[model samples]
Structure formats: structure tokens, C-alpha cells
Target chain A: MKTQHEVEQFLYRQAELLDSKQWQAWIDLFTDDGVYWMPPEPSHRTWEGMPAIFAEDKNLMRVRMGRVLHPDAWSQRPLWGTNHVVSNVVIVKSSTNEVQVRSRFHMMELRRDDVRHYAGAYTHRLKKTRGGYRIKLQRVDMTNAQAAYDYVLQVWV
Target chain B: MLQERIPDFSKFVEPDRVRKEVYTDAGVFEREMERIHETLWIYCGHESQVPKAGDYYAVQLGRQPMLMVRGPEGKVHVLYNRCPHRGNMMCGDRHGNTGEFFRCSYHAWTFHHDGRLRNIPMMESGYQGTRYGRDNPECSMKRAARVESYRGFVFASLAKDGPTLKEFLGASLVAFDDMCDRAPEGEVEIVPNCFRIIQHSNWKIFLENQLDALHPSVTHQSTGRAAHEVEKMIEKKTGKAPLSYHMLSAFATVTIDKWDNFQTINHPQGHCILTGYMGLRPKDPDTLKYEKTLIKAYGQKRMEEILGVNIHHVLIYPGLSVQSPLQQLRAVRPLGVDRTLTEIWHFRLKGAPEAIYRRSLAYYNLVNSPATVVNADDLENFWKCHQGLSSDGGDWVSFARHFGRDIEKDGVVESGPGMGTSEAPMRNQMKAWARYMGNGK
Candidate 1:
């Protein structure tokens, strides 16, 4: 029984958690079966066709988290700093236990001498938890679908 | 005076060995762009990318900017991306449809999809008898020296004469075969998108590392070991570690002995393939359903044969690597002597079960995707290798591990066995490098 404004607050809160690199806290926001997916095709639906990007469950997300913190994780040597700005929040559909939401985001990631802006649209299927809500799926559609880019850092949407 | 000692490129390399400078030299990179990237049958986007008339995708080969477009007459054409009028780029977008013809962005000059001039804006009035006109082919976008397609994959060569595209691909054409054969309908669908990573290192570093069996356990040791620990905990708690752990722990769990158990098959034309590293076949319902569907599409025997084929990685040297087991391909485009761009793309096995595709997608996300820890480990080393090579610590980065132990049978070099320490793959690639950089003796 969360209002639309409350849902928007939840979205922005997730962004803040990411921006602060609160890795484990971010992991706690997902339901057990939640999926983290980013389609290589920015405009494609993950349910309708193959997803170029997919993290099926929490264990995969944990593995990603482990790599981010692992000392041998060489790619993060000069650890990257990110600003996740999630906006355009809208509740697409809602039920007693689950709701679908859509939003747009612009993320600025600074690593070494390179600064990249990742702008995209996101679709989230969330389940209402006893405490609050848990994410079931989050899909990211990037604007630069076809351009050659730096290797992706950890997961995002 | 430094230009005077460009080091006799010929004497520095033999058929089996090459000087490290061939990999870390700026002068050599310039020569490769002209002699190899420009002369060889360089791959462009697939035909499916430009399915409709007037559709085009821009690609760069060496210093030449080119576009692969579908002409109005239903033919795929490869044209230099520059407009002949004022040398402006024809299509600024990576891909788009020009409706019927290309209109230059700088000037309003229009050309047919096949690089034939269609209009000059103010034609007869502006240039009554001038050298420029709509009928002049020179006034249009220039086509590449040669363009051809094989089973829908497009490739263009800047050189007028060399081997045909097929001849150039040689055993390397297995990149296409391994993929197309896996398709139930004899086709694969491009994901319509890609992960592009620009590594601050020489392109050779990435290519050399693709088939190198030695670095994974060391480079990804921490990720692998951490994943392994979590996997054991998960197994104790849940009776099984999710496949994601398998994706990471495989790096740590696949002992040096098991790595030696696998083998690399080196072929001519710089193409090579490593033995399969995964045991993907299982008797699960998802797999059973896929096998049944494949059996129905192909025959029972054909289905069994296709499903049971064991393969893990294929290194189509000089540029591309295909992990058919995972339905992924990484094309290496060298940006400079110390810079490289890797375009990673995943494919879906057309007509396969959605779950099967998901496994491929998971593998794609796990091992090859930029988000994956496996890729992060690999990229870090590419940079470190570049930095280390640039140092004055040593004049040569040795490819001498298990050097003489390689077995040569019918032109294929086979390395025996070792865990996380075989330099054989590097030697094989450098061997091929020597041949390509060497004059055709």
C-alpha cells in the first residue's frame, strides 16, 4: 500500500545507495528470485526476446559484488566513482502484491582519465514486501546501443 | 635519425619466433594498418544488420571509413563513408536508413545507396559544364575496393587483389560454421547491440591473451578463489551452488592438470581453436525439450551429433574470438600501438528454447560481458601488460614456456598439458604473427 510518490522515493533511494557504493545494502533491496538484466539492445523487451545482458538471480549479483570488492579485481584499481541519477519515475501498473514501473536515468562514471555518461531508460517489475518492496526485475535500455564502448563496469540500470 | 633505424623488420622474426617489438611498436602498427587491416578481407557488419533497402552501417577499416548499405536494387554495397563532393562523412550515425539515398550532412549532395550520385541540389544551373555532375561516378560516394558476403556476414577489402574472402578466412571461417551449425534453423540472430570496450593497450595483447591458457588462474585468482569459497558455502547450505558460481569458480576449480587435459588446435591463416572447457549437456527438462525440438528440426542422429559436439573457444586470429559454447563473439580492432577496442556481441540460437538462450545469455553476462568479473580481470592485465612492455625492464616478453614441447602434426601445433601456465598459445599466435608480418617466403 505505497503511494506513487513513495515509489518514486524508493527509486531515488536506490540511486543514492549506488552513488555511495553501498554494495551490500543495494543487494538487500532485491527479492530472492529477482533478476538484474540490461539488454544489449536498448529498446528490446527482455521477456519477448533474448537479452544480451542478464543476471538471473541473487547469487550472480553476489558474484558481481565479490568481484567489485576483491583485491585482485584489477580493473577497479583507481576505483571508479559514479553518480546514478534516476528520474522520470512512473508507475506503469500496480496490483496488491506487485507493480511495474518505468523511469529514465543518466549516470556519470569517472574512472582514471575517462569520464562516461550512461543515459538510459529502465523498466522494473517489483514485488511488495512485508516491510516495503523487493525488485523482481530491472531492465536497462541504453541510448548508445550500437556504438563501440568501454567494457561495462558492474551491473546497473 | 631515429627513423633511419626502423630495425630491419624482416630479420627480427622467423617462422616460429618474433621480436616483441612486432607487438609493441608504433612503426609496426602503422605498417599493419596498411598491409594487413587494409589488404586483408576485413569483416563488416552482417547482412541482417542492413536488411532493408537503403539501410546502412558504418565501419572503419584501418584509416578508411566505410559503410555497408543495402542498395535500392536489393544488393548490399560497401562504399567509402566519405562523400566525394566535399569529402564529408556520408552517414554520421552508426546505423540508419537513408530512405532512398544518402544525403551528406555538410552539403546537401545526395547519392544512391550504391554510391552513385543521384542529385547535386542545384545541378544544371550551378555547374552547366563543370567537371562535377550527377552522372559522374567520381562525384558520388566512393565504393570500397572489394565487398562480398558469406552466408549473410559482410566483409570488405581495401586491396584490389589478394585472396578471396573465403580464401582469407581459411580455417578461420569456422567462426561462422560453429555458430551457424548450432542454429536449429541454420541461422543465428545478432543481439542487435554490443558491448564495446576500449582497452588502453595494444590490440596484440588482447589477441595473444584470448587463447593463452596460463593467465586465467593467476589473473582471476582472487575472483575465482572467492567465488569458490562462496560456492562451497552455497553447496553446504542449499545442496548446490548456482551456475553463476560455476562460471567464476571454474577459473579457480579447473586445476592446472585439467587445463592441460584440454587442448588447443592451431591452424594456418592464424586461426586456432581451444578444446571445450565446459560440460554443458545435462538431462534437465529444459535440455530435453531443446533436444527434442532439435531432433524434430534436424534428424535424430543429426540432433544428437550437434548437441554432443564438444567445443569451448575458437580464436580467429588477427581480430576475432568466438566462444560458440556461450554464443558470443569479440572482434578486436586496434586503435593504436597502445590502444585497442573490443566489440563484444552475443547471438541467440534461432528457434532454440528460451531457457537455452538464457543459459547462453548468462554465460555471455558471466564471462564476456563488461559487467562480468572474468572480463574485468582480463582487461586489467591487458593494461598492465602494455605498461610493463613499455618499461625498460626487459627487451623481450618471452613466449618461451613449454617452447620445444609443442607437437606438430599436419600443420597443427598441439601443446601437451599444464595447469594455468602454458605459453603455447602465445607462441602459436606469435608464430602466425611472424608469418603475416614476414614476407610470404
Candidate 2:
């Protein structure tokens, strides 16, 4: 069994990767069949038969990351500098080879002298592999998920 | 201050150029709300949105807060959200059932789903001879001037007299027909909620961009090129890439000159239609399965006819843009001179396979969603355009591309040969705007 300290360290490392815009490293943290999801509404319980802010499999994630990192992505021409702070970690469930962790995230993104605050709760289901623990599913429920947004949500929560 | 400074409408709009104030001036925006939006036939929610009786969806028509409700008699009614008693809004939530009647939280005034007065507290004793009475139409919730539905899509007009919804739709009714005809059951249901996005530009700017074919290659080139590279890699590695990649890659592969082949038909009422260019018919297993189902529901000949209707985007005058082929729609509501709210909704083809529905959903997510790379660039351009127009950077917005090349006959304009990149749609819209602004017919 992995100790709570070990799991917390792992979580912090993931946040560090995202904050540093380490796209390849962040992608490597996901399992072969991993899923990343952000529901359109807080009440949305499932991704099946409904729309999502983001419901990306590996291929879709690859496309998204490629677009964001591409030189010609004009929207990202002045790249966003983000700080992701993950806190209030709790182990929701644990099994012999898998665990589900819940955490609160406060992400502040700065672009072109404008700063936007994004707060969300993340539910991550991780599975222990031969190399290390990898994400099976990462579901982000943004506080303003259903509200009308002024601009595009360029990056993942 | 703005009223006196308001420029003459005729002087502001010409054949090839429009004054920037039409897009940036607060006075022009107010006049638009009063003259164009309030007088026109504005779209309400679909009937399927309120399938059950008493189900209601609150909407904004011009400056009025209204509710589209399914009455107990199974009829849809568009009524003002305000209660007649104290003018308190009856339905505060975006959508919900008010039981069989709408009850005011402030005054305990009860109304039927059709906006008739059902009951009021102490009415018999409190207003025995007062002006308030159940039979008086003024005492009940007010209704729109006209309410009509074209194939389950409801629209309401606030003006008492004008063209009927059909007359107004004219050739543009093809938008709904093309969508419903694709459904084996000849109807569609909304996919519950929609993505509500606020664009920091004039509503006209958003509408104009819908039929603008030249901007996609320039604005969305990054996303398209990225997808194309990945698509080629996947094809090299696995001998094939999914159809979704093609949807994105087409943006890059379809060069700017090729856009001229797809014609834009401009109608009299400011509505415009763009013919399809994307190859939606793939003979993949999923598509074949969907085609088989369609063939079974509709005979072979009818199925062929249904599938043969090629449409890319239909701009319905001042508000809606419908992509019938993909079952996607966007409704625009102007909030201010520089602020506009757009509701992006996608539909499911009834009696079609789940795979077909997934295709629509994929397009919705990959192309139209606020988080999408394609839409993000467009939003940035819209904001930049608004900022530039608001500044002294320019005075006139040009629509002179292929000017005087549009073939006009019976008040309908069609792009000339190899002129699909024409700005006829924008010019036609401004002409209609001028008429609606009480300048010209």
C-alpha cells in the first residue's frame, strides 16, 4: 500500500507539471485508457448521452495539447501562465491496485495582463501500474460550470 | 446624449460600406432593440424542450422577459414572465414546471400555464368592484403578439401585425426542413442544456461571421493544420484516422479558392444560406448502419432525397444560425452595445443510430464548444474587432467583396459564378436592417 505522504507527493508533482506547462510530462501521467472530463453542469453525473465542457480520450487530448503548443495557435500566441494550487486532499476509496482521490483546485491564469480565477473540485481515479500510479479518470467539476463565460476556457482545469 | 448624436440611418449604411457606429454606437443598439428585435419574429425554445405540460423555459425577446410554457391543454404559449398583480416575475428559474399553473412568489397570484388568471389571494373580497377581474385580459399575464411553430421550432413576435412566420421565413424555412428531413422520425429533440457564451462584440458581428467563408482558412488555420499533421501521422502509423480528424483537417485542406465554389444565397428578409462543401457522407460501418436505418424508416427513394439535401449554414436574419447538416444551432441575444450572449445547442436525429448522434456531438464539442480551438480563435477575433471598431482605427466596415456581382431577381440575391466569397450576405443584412430601421423597404 502507498502511504498518504507518497500519494500527496504524487498529487503535488502533477500540479507542478501543469503549472510549469509540461505538456508531455502531464500526458505521461495518464494511463493508456485514461479519461479526462469536465461536466457542463454540476448536476451532470455521467458523460454518456450528454455534452461536456471536455470529455477527452487519449487521441482528443493529443489533439488539444498539440493545438495549444503549436506555434500558429493565435489564441495562445501570448501563452497563458497559470498557477495551480491543489489542496484538501482526501482519499475517497482505495483498493489493492486502485485508489480514488478528491481534491480542491484553485487555478489562476494570467494572459495579456488579464487574470482569471478558476476554482474546481477534482475527482481522480488512479491505478497502480508497473512504472507508477497513473490516472484512470480525472473529473473536474468547475464552480461556474453552467454559467455563461466571457472568453474561451483555453486550458484544462 | 446619444439620441441627438445618432447619425442618420440612410447615411450610415451604403451599398458597399457601413458606418462603424452601427456596430459600436449605444444609440443604434437601443434603436435596434426597439425597431428590429422587438418587431421581428424571434425564436423561442423548441416544443420538445417543454414536452410535458407546465414545463416552461424563460427567454428574452428584445428587452422583454418572457416564458415559453406547455399549457395543460398541450399547447405551447409564449407569455410575459411578469405577473399582472405586482409585476413580479413568475418564473425565475431558467426552466421548470410551475405545477399546472404559474404562481407568483411575491403576491400568491396563481396563473394557468397559458397565462390566464387561475386564482389570486382574497380576490373576491379585495377587488369586488375594483378594475382587477379574472375576465379582464389586462389582469392576466400578457402574451406575445403572435406565437407559431414551424415543425416543432417555436417563434414569437412582439409586433401586432407583420408577416406571418412562414412568410418571413420564406426560402429560409429550408433550415428546419433540412434538419427534420434527416431524422427518420421527422423530428428532433434538444440535447437538454446548451453552452451559454458571451461574445464581446455586436450581435451583428457574430451573425456576419457565420456566413463569412474567407475567415475560417485564415483564423482557424492553426487548429486545422495541427489536426491535419496528427491525422497524417495517424494515417501513416495505422493506415487510417477517424472521421473526426477529417472534420477539423478540412479547414486546412479546403483552400481559400475552393470556398468560391460553395454559393451563398441571400434572401429578401436578410436570411442567407450557404451550400455544403464538407463530405459528410462517409461509407464507414457506422454511417452505413445509420443509412440502413434511414432506408428502413423511409423508402429508398425518399431516403436518398433526405440525404441529398446539402446545406452548410443558414443565417436566419437577426438571431439564429443553423447548421442543419450537423444538427447544431446558435441563438444570439444582444445584451449591450458591446456584449452579446449566444446559446449553442445541438440536436439528436430521432430514430437514427447512436453513432450518428455521436458524430453530431463530436462536431458540437470539437468545433462549436467554447473550449474548442476553432471557436476560441473566432472569439478572440470578435473581441479584437470590437476593440478596433470602438477606437478611431477605422470608420467604415467594408462589404465590397464582389459587390454588384450578386444576381438579384424577385428580391432574392445569389452570388455570381465563382463568387461564394462574396460579401452579399452582409450587404443584404444591412439592407434589411435599413428597412427595419424605417429607412427603406
Candidate 3:
């Protein structure tokens, strides 16, 4: 049985990987068929009906990772330095091989001396793997999902 | 303030160059809001936005906060959002049903969807015959000088009299026609909400860049190259790359010199249209299925004619850019001299299959969304352009490329042979601006 402390540690490790821009390690945390979604609005319950900020499968995620890691990605010419603070972690559901965890996150991103704070709720569906845990589905709901933004939101929150 | 600081409008705008103050000076920006935006037929919202009788969408037309609502008889009305009493905004939220009447939260003053006063609390007891009557036009919300819709696309004019919306649109009316004609049902419906992005640049810079064919290779080369590599990899592994990749990789493959192959047609009203460069009609199963449906609905010959309309982007003067082929549009709202808000909205081709709608959605997310690298690159250049124009290092912004190589027939300007990369759109826009500002008229 995986304890709450184990789940918390797993989430913290994932945050560190993303914060450090460890692209390969971060992508590795997702299963072969994993999904990452960020709905465009708070009222969005499914990704099918309306457009989303991001509703990427493994292939699209790989493309996004490639763009961010590429030296020529001008938007990320100097990569955004981010610190993700994950809290209020709760295991919403659990089984022998899979778990659904919900948590709140506050991400502080800095690039070109400009800082932006993004707060949101994250719901992650994870599965136990031989090496560790792989993300089955990761859904992020940004607090300012509906607000007009000054620039492109290039990072995952 | 700008009347004294800036030179004559004739000196500021020429056929091939424009003074930097036109894009950088705050005073000039305000004047533009008064002379251009306020005097033009600015796009408000789609008719589908307010489908129901009480539904409304709050929008900004130049400096005025306005609401586009549907009345009891299913007629659309555009009115200033200010309440008659105390001048508070009536609709606070971005959009919602006003429940048959709009009631101001501050004082409970009510008005019908058509902006006629419905009731004021205790009107008979509190006050009477003191210029607060229900019949007084001043006591109700002020309507726009004129409101009209062309093919479900709504536009409002603040000027009391001018050319009708049709006259203003002129040849540019094809933007809506081409979009609606694509749908098998011969109409379109909005896909609910849109992506509102605030760009830190002069609004003109955004409009000019919409038809500028010279920068795609330099600005989006990296993203395009990356997507190209992945697309090739996918083709090797799966025998085909998705259509979404072409949407990005085209930025690289369509080199600067090749951009000349696609011509831009300049219109009298400052509107411009760019001929399509990308081959959107892929022969995949999804596309084939969609084509078959179109053939059945529109017939083989009519379907070919509908799909054969080749256009990339159409600029509707100073305020809107429509990508009819992709079923997307962007409405430009100038908030300040250096801050512009763009509302990016996509449409669903009614009666088309789910796969066709998905294609539009993919284009929306990959090319137009604020989260995409393609749009990010454009945003960066917009900011940089504004920053450079603000500095004294440059005095004149050049539109000199292929300036003398444009042919005028009737009232429309077409690029000369092999001069498709010309800055005719920018020149044409300034010409119209000069006229509107009372310099060339």
C-alpha cells in the first residue's frame, strides 16, 4: 500500500523535475499513452465540446517538449525559470495499480526579469509502474483561464 | 495636443513611408480613436453570440463600452452600456442572459434589451416630471448610430451618417461570404468563448502584420523547422504526418522569396486580402469524408466552387482580420497607445462532420491561440516593433518595398507581377488613414 507521504513525495519530485527543466525526466513520468490537458475555462468539464489551451497526447507533448528545449524556440530563448509550489495534496481515489490525486499549485515563473504568478488546481491520474509512477492523465485548471494575457503561456502549470 | 506637436498629416503619411509619430505618439493614438475607429464600421460580435432573446455580449467599440443584445422579437441591438441613472455599467459580466431586461446593480434601474427604459424603482413616488420619464430617449441607454450584420457578422458605427456597412465592406464582404459558403448548411455558429490576448504594441502594427508576407520566414523559422523535423520523423514511422504540422512547418517551407508568389489585393476602404498559399485540402480519410459530404450537400460543381475560393487572410480595415478558409477571426480593440486587445474566435461550419470542425480547432490552437509558438513569435515582433518605433533612432517607417509596382484598376489596387511581397497593404492603409484624418480628402 502506498502511503500519503509516498504520494506527496512523488508529486514533489515531479515538481522539481519541471522546475529544473529536466525535459527528458519530466516526459518520462508520463505513461506511453498519457494525456495532459488544460481547459480554457473553469466551467469546462470535458475537452471534446470546447477548445482548450492544451489537450495534448504523447505525440503532441513530445512536439511541445522539443520546441521548448530547442535553442531556437525564441519564446523560450532564455527558458522561463519556474518554481512550482504544490500543496493540499489529497488522494481522491485509489486502487492496487492506479490512483487519482488532486492538489492545488502556485507556480511562479520568471523570464526576462518579468515574473508571473499562476495559481490553479491539478488533478492527476497516476498508475503504479515498475520504476515508479507514471502519469495517466494530468488536468490543470488555471485561475486566470478566461482572462486576457499579455503574452504566450509557454510552460506547463 | 498632437495638432501642435505632430506635423501635417500629409507629411506624416506618404505613398511609401509614414512618420514614426503616427505609431508611437500617444496624442496621435487618441486622435486615431476619434477619427478612425469612431468613424468606421467596427465589428461588434457575431449574431450567434446572442442566440436567445435575452442573451447579450459586452464589447468595446473604440472608447465606448457597448452591449450587443437580442430583443424580444429576435432583433439585435447595440447600445452603450452606461445606465441612465448615475452612469454605471448595466452588464457587469462579460456575457450572460439579462433575463428579459437589463437591471443596473447600483440603483435597480431597468431597461429592455433594446435599451428602452423598462422601469425605475418607485418612479411615481420618488420622482416625476423631472426629466426622468420612461419616454425620454436620454433616460434610456444610448444606441450606436447604426448597427448592421452581413452574413451573421455584426458591426456598429458610431458616426450618425456615412456609407452603409455594405458600402464600407465593398469587395471585402467576400470574407463573410467565403466563410458561410463553406458550411454545408450555408451558415456558421460561434464556438462559444474566445481567446482574449492583450498585445503590447500599436494597433496598426497588428493590422499591418496580418497581410505582411515578408516576416514569416524570419520570425517563425525555428518553430517551423522543429515541426518539420518531427513531421518527417512521423512520416517515416507512421507513413504520414498530421495536417497540424503543415500549419506550422509552412512557416519555414514558404521562404521569404516564395512569399512573393502569393499576391495581396488592396481595396479602397483600406481592406486587403492575401491569396492562399497553403494547400488545406489534404486527401486524408477525414478530409475525403468531409469532401463527400460537401459534394452531397452542395453538388459536385458547386462544392468545387465553394472549396475553390482561395484566401489566407482578409483585413477588414482597422479592426478585424478574418481567415475564412480556416474559420477563424480576430477583432482588434485598441486599449491604449501601446496596449491592444485582440479577441480570437473560431467558428464551426454548420452541417459539416466532426472531423472538419476538429481541423478548424486544430488550426485555432496551433496558429492563433496565445499559447502557441507561432503566435508567440508574432507577439514578440509586435512588441519589438513598437519599442523601436518609439525610439528616436528611426524617424520614418518604410513601406517603400515595391511601392511603384502596384496597378490600380477601377478603385482596387493589385500587386504588379512578381511583386507579391510588396508593402502595398500598408501604403493603401495609410492612404485611407490620411483621407479619414482630413489630410488627403
Candidate 4:
């Protein structure tokens, strides 16, 4: 079993990878069957038949990263920059090979001529392996999930 | 006395182009709200949204705040959100049940679910000699002039005198029929909640893009190319990739010139239907099971006829855009001259298999959701278009692509052969707009 300090270190490193736009490394933090979910509503428990802001598997994540990183993505023309502050980490439950974690994040994204703030809580289910801990599922509940955005969100929160 | 200068609205629209003022002018936007949005039948929420009695959903119809409430007998009524007592708006929340009756929090005035006056606080003591009484209809909340539903999708018109909803819908009624008919139970139910987006552009831009077959290739090329690359890699590795990848890659696979294979039928009422191009009928196990279920519900030939109705997108005049094949729709509500609000809602085929619903969910998340690259790029273009139009860069927005080549038969305009990229839909919409704005009907 990993200690609380080790879990905090893992989360901080994950945030660093995201802020630096390390697409592949950020994705590698997840297992092969990992799911990245941003539910449209906090009451949404599953992504099977309900509409979600994002319910991507590994393949879909790769597609999203490729599009955002592409040359002709006009939405990313001014080049988006995000700073992430992940804190309040709490290890809800830990077993021999699995751990459930809860935390809060505030991401400020700068695009073109506007800055948008996204504050959310995350619940991560991590499975321990030889290399390190890999995410099995990451559920994001955004505070402003129902806000009428000025434009479409191009990147993950 | 200062004479008001009457603007000639007809001069702003020609047979092949429209003046930019039509999109940018505040006065023109006000006129559009008065003559087009308020006068026409605008789509309200689906009937399934307020399935139980006393349940209500708040919606905006043009500049008026409205509510769709299920009455005592499961009938849906559209009412103005204002209370008759002091004009204090009732139901400040987005949606909730009013319990037994709608009681105004300001003065304790109550109204029935159908907008009828139910009771007033201390009627005998407070207003014994006053004109206000239970018999006065003005004491209750006002209602929309007309409320109608087509196969469970409700629509309301503020104008009492005009074509009925069916007459106005005309050929576009197929949008609703095609959606509900595909279900095994011959109906669809709302998947509650929606993704509401506010685009910083005129509402017309969104309706025009619904059938503008030319921009998908140019605007979304990056997304398509990226998805295609990953799809090819996945296929090489796993021998076959999932169908979800093709949902995006098709944006690239179908090049600009290839878009000509699809066509649009532009109705006189400003509605348009784009022909289907997506290959939704793969012979996979899940699909085969769906087909079997459909065949069992609607006989073999009937099921074939139902599924064979090929449609990709349908624009219902001033407000709704329905993607019937995928059971999703986007309702446009104009918030201001330069602001438009869109509610993206999806539905479930009532009795279809779970896998079928999952497919619909996948398409909703991948294509319609605000997070997807497809929607992001489209929004960027919308913003750019609005900014350019608002500037003094140019005066006329051209719709001259194959203008005179369109074939008009029995008032229905269709693109000429091999002219699928024709701007006939926009022209038709402008012509309808000119009529609506000129006559004020």
C-alpha cells in the first residue's frame, strides 16, 4: 500500500504533466481500460446511456489530443494555456492494489482574448501496478457545469 | 416633430444576397423577434420533460419568458411566467413543480396548472368592493396563443391567427415522424437535462449552418484528419477500430467535392432537410439485434420503409434543428442582437436495445457536446462571422453559389443536379424573412 504522501506526489505530478501539455505522458497515467468522464450533471452516476460533456476511452482521448494539437485547429489558433491548482487531496479508501481518491481543482484557461475559470472536484479510482499507480476511472464534477458558455470548451478541465 | 425614418426591409435582401445590416442592426433584430420568432411556432420542451402533473420547465420564446407545465390531466400548457397580480415573475427557478397550484410568493395569489385563476388571498376581506375577483380572467397568468404537439414534441405560437402547426411544419414534419418511428415502441422520451450554449453571434448564423454543406470540410478538416490518423493506427493494431472513430473521421473522409452527392430540399417556409450521408446501418451484432427488434415491432417491410427514410438533418424554420437519425436536436433561442442560446437535447428510442441508446449517446458526446472539436471549431467560425459582419468590412453577404440554377417545383426549391453546395436554402430563408418582416404577420 502506498502512503498518503506518495498519493499526493502522484496527483501533483499528474497536474504538472497536464499544465505542460504533455499529452502522451498524461494519457499514459491511465490504464488501458481507463475512462475519462466529465458528467453533464453531478447526479449522473454512469455514462452508459446518459449525455455527458465527455465520456472518452483511450482511443477517443487520443483523438481529442490529436485534434487540439493539430496545426489547423482554429479554436486553438491563439494557443490555449492552462494553469491547474489541484489540492485538498483525500484518500477515501485504499486496498492492497487499488485506491480511491478525492480532490479539488481550479483550472484557469487563457485563450485568444479571454480567460475562463473552471473549478471542479475529481474522484479518481487508481489501480497499483509494477510501474506505478494508473487511473481506472476519473470522474469530474464541475461547479459551473450548467453555465451557458460563450464558446465551446476545447480542452479538458 | 421628428419624423421616424422607415427602413425598407425589402431593400436589404436580394435574390442572391443579403445586406450585413440584417445580421448586425439592432432594429432589424427587434423586427425579426416581433415578426418571425414571436409570430411563428417555436419549439418548446418535449412532452416527456414534464411527464408528471404539476411539473414545469422554464423556457424562453423570443423575448418572453415562458413555462411548459403539465396540468392536472397530463396536458401540457405553455404560460407566460409573469403573475397577473403585480407582474412579478413566477417560477424563478429554471424548473420545478408548483405542487397543487401556482401560488405567487409576492401576494399569495394562486392559479391552476392551466393558467386559470384559482384563489386570491383574503378575497372577501381584501377586495370586497374592488374589480379583482375569481371570475376575472386577467387575474390569472397569461398563456401562449396556441399550443400544439407533433408526436410528443411540443411547440407554441404567440400569434393566434396563422397557419396551424401542421400547416406551418409542412414537409419538415418528417423530422419528428422519422425520429419517433425508428423506435420499437413508435415513440421517444426525453433524456432529461441539456447542454445550453450561448454563441456570440446572430441566431440566423446557426440556422444557416444547419444545411450549409460546404463548410464542414474546410472548418472541421483538422478534427477529421486527427481522428482519421488515430483510426488508421487503431485499425492497424486491432484489425478493426470502433464505429465511434468513423463518426469523426468521416468529416475528413468525405471531401468537399464529395459533399455534392448529398442534397437538400428547401421548403417555402424556410425549413430545409439535408439528405443522409452517414452509414448508420452496419451489419454488426448490436445493429442486427436492433433490426430484429424493429422487424418484430413494425413488420419486415414496414421496418425497412421506416429505416429507409434517409435524412441527416432537418431545420424547422426559425428555431429547431433536428438530427432525426441520431435522435438529438438543438433549439435556438435568441438572447440578443449578437447573442444566441442553443439547448442541445437528445432522446432515447423508447423500446430500443441498450446498445442502440449507447450509440446515440456516443454520437451526442462525440459530435454535439461542447467539448468536442467539431462543436468548438463551429463556434469559433460563428464568432468570427459575427465579428466580420458587425464591422464595416463588407455590406452584402453573398448567397450566389448556383443561385439561378436551382429547380423550383410547386413552391419547393431544390438544388440543381450536382449542385448540392447551392445556397438555395439561405436564399429561401431570406425570401421568407422578407415576407415575414414586410407584412408583420
Q: Indicate the TM-score of model 2.
A: 0.96
Candidate 4 clash figure, as a count: 0
lDDT of candidate 3 over B113-151, digit per residue (tens)? 889998989998876758777877888989999999999
Q: Between which residue pairs do clashes occur in model 4?
A: none
Model 2: colliding residue pairs: none
Question: What stretches of model 1 exceed 4 Å from their correct place?
Answer: A1-13, A39-42, A47-49, A52-56, A77-80, A83-147, A155-157, B1-6, B11-20, B122-129, B133-136, B225-245, B417-421, B438-441
Which candidate number would show the highest lDDT if scored against the true structure? Answer: 4
Q: Which candidate is the best by TM-score?
A: 4
Candidate 4: misplaced stretches above 4 Å? B1-4, B439-441
Per-residue alpha-carbon lDDT of model 1 for B1-441, expressed as tens digits?
Answer: 754554556665654455667768798888788777887777787777788998888787876778899987789999999988778888888788989888988878888888888888788899888988876668878888999877667888898988898887776666677677677887887776667778888887887788777677778876787788778878999887656578779888876556676677777667777776477777778888888888888989988777666677788767878787677888777888988888777877888888888787667666766566687778778878888878877766777767777777887777765422456677777666656665434
Between candidates 1 and 3, the one scoring higher on DockQ is 3
What is the lDDT, from 0 to 100, of the residue A105 in candidate 4?
95
Cα lDDT tens digits for candidate 4, B1-441:
212454778999999999999999998898889888998999999999998899999999999999999998989999999999899998998889999899898988999999999998889898788888887789889999999999999999999899999999999999999999999999999988688888989999999988898989888888999899999999999888778788889889999998887788999899999886568888889989999999999999999998898898899999899999889999999999999999999999999998888887888888888787698888889999999999988999999999899999999999888888889999999998898888432
| lDDT-best of 2 and 4 | 4
What candidate 3 gets wrong by more than 4 Å, as runs, is B1-7, B439-441
Candidate 2, after superposition: displacement of residue B393 in Å?
2.3
Best-first order by DockQ: 4, 2, 3, 1
The DockQ of each candidate is 0.46, 0.70, 0.62, 0.78
